[model samples]
Target: MTEEFLVAKDLRKRFGDVPAVDGVSFTIRRQEIFGLLGPNGAGKTTIIRMLSTTLEPDAGGIEIGGRSVAEDSVGVRALIGVCPQELALYPELSARDNLVFFGRMAGLGSRQAKEAAAENLELVGLLDRAKDAVRKFSGGMKRRVNLAAALMSRPHLLFLDEPTVGIDPQSRNHIFETILRLRSEGMSVLYTTHYMEEADRLCSRIGVIDHGRLISLGTPAELKSAIGPPDEVTLEQVFLNLTGRNLRD
Candidate 1:
């Protein structure tokens, strides 16, 4: 397999007169965790949408596993699993049912869907609560189920958008461990989050986006070193220095 699992070139997207993504480009390699860090309205979400084949770019191009996103969206979708920032779950359904439903949506057979649901639930430490209604579960528990649903596709690349947002420390740590384990198992991940420390700990490389453009790209150590002494510099410091402290809408 090629080292590069995902590639985008000069991607540009405009909504009306506003350019949401302006000439953004990056690549995610096999078994690598690539972080995309930006404040609100940085266009990372637009980038993710284009990468995941949910939204077509008005300009530029994208290829995942050598298949062009515009020409082969079906093929691209088969190789990717997207865990969106928003919860995509049937809250009234049991956790097991929710996963099974998503598995079926991913094109698994009924038997395969059930089996995958059980496996994913176990993977997320939610097997014991599989039959519980999702509405009764805590936010952390629901987020775990969301991750499990995304895995039903058995994808080669995963798009995780703010996966640990608003979760407890235990849930966040569980997610961190899960992402690391997936990478070790050869899954390429495109991760986006507002948490600089999380990116610092988990990403092999990080690309910082601001005002709809890629402003910086490097390993966490390199990025820190760019701002100050590596050991003395924090990712948050680097982020603030690059993006400034102004509040984003």
Candidate 2:
């Protein structure tokens, strides 16, 4: 069996009177890509933040490679990389500079950070624009840099929250390819997105979260089978049936 790289048990979190995450539980195996599928206000981002150690869960346990985030947050942070839905970049800085800064924060030496930053930028096909400031780049270019920054530390576990949002088809495909390559190279990924097609294309298993609770969990085939068959039912139909068609604001 593949070793579990990430584990969450009865994870719970609340904001004010709203329960953002309630009793969520799952495990991601090494080299596997797991998708968290949900609509807006479904608590996807809340769960990502908790797993990345950016936000503490109000209750429950989270472990990354057997290290508890609550007990060893620093250790957990070092072991996981996160690319949030919001672009976290310094618009005034060059992509190289931005990556170097993030790498340094991850404990790389200044010279080593710059070297790694260049390599990562190249890996994401942004080497030509390495010296250009992010303010002058397009939305897709900025998103690429955002992902490169997260990979500076070469994290074992990666959390991507809607990484391909608002990008062109070419850029979106590039991001998808990058994610596939990472999993092939033995990195465990927890991806959160509302795109059913993306989930069907990449995830080994998907967990559907609705109103802060897990409503369903299974492989794409299994999920489609649960409703019927791939020819008879689509992932979007299954999602709608489970989550309902009501709009969430």
Residue 232 lDDT (model 1): 98
Q: Model 1, 1-249: lDDT tens per residue?
A: 778999999999999999999999989999999999999999999999999999999999999999999999999999999999888899999999999998898899999999999998988889999999999999998889989889999999999999999999999999899889888998999999999989999999999999889999999999999978999989999999999999999
Query: Which number leads on lDDT?
Result: 1
Per-candidate alpha-carbon RMSD to the true structure = 0.7, 1.1
lDDT of each: 0.93, 0.92
Steric clash pairs (candidate 1): none
Assess every candidate by TM-score.
Answer: 0.98, 0.98
lDDT of candidate 2 at residue 129, scale 0 to 100:
94
lDDT for 228 in candidate 2 is 90
Give candidate 1 misplaced runs (Cα > 4 Å): none
Residues 65-167 of candidate 2 have per-residue lDDT tens digits of 8899999999999999999888899999999999999999999999999999988898889999999999999999898999999899989999999998999
